[model samples]
Target: RAGLRFITCHEAFASAYSDGTAVRVTTDPERTQAEFARCSAADCEGWRSLVAIYRRIAPHVLPFTNMPLPSGAAAFHALRMAAGLRGAMLDLRHVIFGSSGQLVDRFFRTDAAKGAVLPWGFHQDFGPAVKGGAAFAFVAALSAHMKGLVVAQGGADAIVSALRRLIEDGGGTIRTATQATEVLVEGGRAVGVRTSTGDVLSASRAVIANVTPPLLFGQLLPAHSVPDRVRKRAMAFRYGPGVFMVHLALSRPLAWKAGDDLHRFMYVHLNGKPDEIAGTYAQCTTGLLPSRPVIVVSQPTHADPSRAWAGCAAMRLQVRAVPAIIAGDAAGTIRGRGWADIKDAFADRIIGQLEEHAPGARDVILARHVMSPEDFERENSNLIGGDCVSGSHHLDQNYLRRPFPGWTRYRTPVERLFMIGASTWPGGGVNAASGYLVAQDLLGQASKKAPQRGIER
Candidate 1:
């Protein structure tokens, strides 16, 4: 809470940063803004409990929220949206000899490590989801003027639109059709880029490549400039499976077997237990989706009504696994019994599961968009075949080990070349924290001559 100097619920409608401009929260075009106001700040508010309160609850209590307990069936579903606690739940390796092994006082240390790194970076390394720390970080950056209001291509349309307003407000340039091809380094000195259009645009300050690791090291910078360790690691890097997303326009909000309010966000899926999760991960490791895959179902439409058209809801159902999920190759999979023919046919089965968790699922579904891993790879190269995180988020490939051993802070061996994407540290997604971090590094360098303001976190 102390770190979060500001939180931007909606900026296009209202500049959260006090710049003598604040739009009314209740406005027509800002309907999205109004809806965002309702979606709870699950992180900030839930941190209000005392240490004693936490002592009474650890594994039983979700670290992000202080909500009530979930029923067994609901808890099973919640595992998918978990901050990645599938293995932790069944971990008896270091337990104190045949104890019930519940999350008691002694196990507080398990969550302690989270507190240590978490308070620093927004990518808290929990699980599939984030704790809104990046939002706080970006809003703080905007307020402090450390980073520009201009946020480029963060997957979320709402966030992108608000940032666009800020960029346009600041009279900043929004260059499009400019795909950065290669970094032009002269005698180990940082130079600029060679765009696909053959335009040689030079950065007066720094060269930050906001693309994937393979693209940055392999494509943007030359092979020679990259160190062996970086090269070896990047080469060793595993490009995980693509994600399959099902976006549905529902006719009404979902009805859930709700125990706690937060249960609404709890992800329900098919896989039964740890063995199932393990088997799924194993299948993904070798290249295949688990026979019965685990799916994460998030109804953002339930939380934010503006996400859909009038009388329509948006359903986001996703699963991240290897190519085998989609039968390796769509053509081959379809040729014999393709991933699509199978998955599309099974979509109704998934819908049946959704109907159980969300009573109104089938009844409300008006139109649907099913996205497979193959589809994702074709859409965004950054996704690297639906590995939405640029690359795998495994322990070995995460943190300092990310991209390369020594390269973490967006900088490469070649002078002035920096990185800023999900591929970069504190990796991945709508979190503009990576861009802000990279921007801070760039602005600090840029201010050395251009006279910019003091750098802030």
Candidate 2:
């Protein structure tokens, strides 16, 4: 395997900025309490409420671990209990509600006078996931506080290299630049795959697809081979709002008005009032770019200097809740042109916003690469409109109900065909829970089928 290392940092550890003020969140409960105590009374109360809710849910959910549990009634009951509710019916909105019967945002408005809610939407992709039950978002925040953040020492490429080495060491061959055109099926069983170059690679055991449902059902598989109902579900699979990313190579590190703490934390969220965050999501859903969108500024060079050249920095600006296809601009400044035409102007607007928080952000940029939603789809069809999560995490499409009902265990109706990746349970993120679970299932089946070691049939 490739010799790679990882750098573990505190999870849920981020510095949130609004206007000129800032608040740093960390894993230590006492430290978090002490930090917020200096803020307004309302801010303190809001932070306490979020912590309280997390505490209540922690015992029941065990969000950090990937232990397998029963998928039916027992799972539902445990989830409901974790949210501190007593009933069969439960959703994300119910899970995050405070004692006042309102959402957690009602309690945790950082700038109460300015009406700024905590930017929970930063953890989610779609508008509904932001507007509705942010149960997963809340769990993610709490888990970060509990587990701390873990990153590869060299970078994410370190992970790819390690996996590549493992595959090669195991005598497995990886064909790069090869596109799978169709899944060759024989008698309702997946037998092999036909590549774009017309090479048929047969599968000995199973065909595991990491692509989206649409690509799997519509393009890769024979239309008549799949059931009508399953096909319909794939067609109706909802995708979340796409992402707009700006990668920059900076001549120097960012100079923020908030101080060096900004450089310490890995993620800096730039947002305004809670209402503005909500409005931005609403606008994106309607195919319009928000006048003021929430932006995530990350400086990897701070964590690992090797990422940048000497005396230089490597940074990324990720703007959330942007539309995949542009119909209008809320600021009414950038014309509603296609991504190719408007991406640069949009990047300029985003950079201007960054400059507002970090005064010297624009001056430090030596080179920049912009990846709009369109670019994401062009590069990887799985993105399907630049949705990094693959599919939406709405209530209907989450948990055991994910991908689609009746096929949640990674098995498909077609024999020897399985599915995994972000589209499966334990939904999105860098975690390989889906792949791990699928591997476990396949190993279990293989063990069951193997003949006794001493006495062969």
lDDT of each: 0.47, 0.72
lDDT of 1 by residue, 1-457 (tens): 2111222222221111111111111213234223222332321122212122223323442221211112243366456435444444433222212111121112212222112112111112212122223222222222222221222222256565666777877886667767777888887866888889998988776777777777666667787776767766666666656666777777765655432231223133333223333454555555554454445555444334556777665667666554534434221322323555655744655576555544556777788888766667667667766677676545556555565566765667777777767676555645566667667666766678684557775
Q: Which ranges in model 1 have alpha carbons more than 4 Å from their true place? A: 1-155, 227-229, 257-272, 322-343, 356-360, 446-457
RMSD of 2: 3.6
Error of 1 at 76 (Å): 40
Q: Using lDDT, give the best candidate's number.
A: 2
How do the residues 1-457 of candidate 2 rate in per-residue lDDT, one tens digit apiece? Answer: 3798776565244544644666666677776666666566676776777667666556666542353333554577665665564432243336543211135445554453222224544456634234334565466555666665666767788899899999999999999899999998999999999999999999998899998888898889899889999988877788888889999999988878777666656666776445566678888989998788878777667667778888888888888678888889988999856999999999999899888888878888899999999999999999988998888877678766778887777777789888888887767788787778778778989999997788766
Q: lDDT (0-100) at residue 47 of candidate 1?
A: 24
Clashing pairs in 2: 6-153, 10-149, 11-148, 11-149, 92-133, 93-133, 116-274
Per-model TM values vs. the true structure: 0.61, 0.89
- Residue 234 of candidate 2: its Cα lDDT? 77
